[model samples]
Target: MKSEYLRITGGTPLEGTVRAAGAKNAITKLLV
Candidate 1:
């Protein structure tokens, strides 16, 4: 299956707490 990727350009320093929730059976892989 094809997968989507993400790219980030110039941006101010990020601050504050970040949180994420993932699926129990999710597949994770690194592209490039």
Candidate 2:
């Protein structure tokens, strides 16, 4: 599995890079 960096913002003025899976990975996991 691979990870991606996501920029989070808007909530509580959050600003940082978060480690996350790709959309495909998320959807695949959900399907499974």
Candidate 3:
């Protein structure tokens, strides 16, 4: 058997007016 690793980093250095909108019937599903 062997070993594994995962690394993740960094997001969003934002400096401004940001607007976001979603739908009326928004559905999200995630499976792992």
Question: Candidates 1 and 2: which is better by TM-score?
Answer: 2
- What order do candidates take by TM-score, descending? 2, 1, 3
| Model 3: lowest-lDDT 10 consecutive positions | 23-32
Global lDDT of each model?
0.38, 0.47, 0.31
Model 1 / residue 4 / CA error / Å: 12
Query: Which model, 1 or 2, shows the larger lDDT?
Result: 2
Report clash pairs, candidate 2.
Answer: none
| Model 1 stretches astray by more than 4 angstroms | 1-8, 22-32
Q: How close is candidate 1 to the true structure, as a TM-score?
A: 0.27
lDDT of 1 by residue, 1-32 (tens): 95543343466664563232452123222211
lDDT for 32 in candidate 1 is 19
Q: Model 1: how large is the Cα RMSD against the reference?
A: 9.3
Look at candidate 1 and give me any clashing residue pairs. Answer: none
From the highest lDDT down, the ranking of the candidates is 2, 1, 3
- Clash-forming residue pairs, model 3: none
Provide TM-scores for the models: 0.27, 0.29, 0.20
Writing each residue's lDDT as its tens digit, candidate 3 over 1-32 gives 85433222358453553222442123221111
C-alpha positional error of residue 18 in candidate 3 after TM-score superposition, expressed in Å = 29
Who wins the TM-score comparison?
A: 2
Q: What TM-score does model 3 achieve against the real structure?
A: 0.20
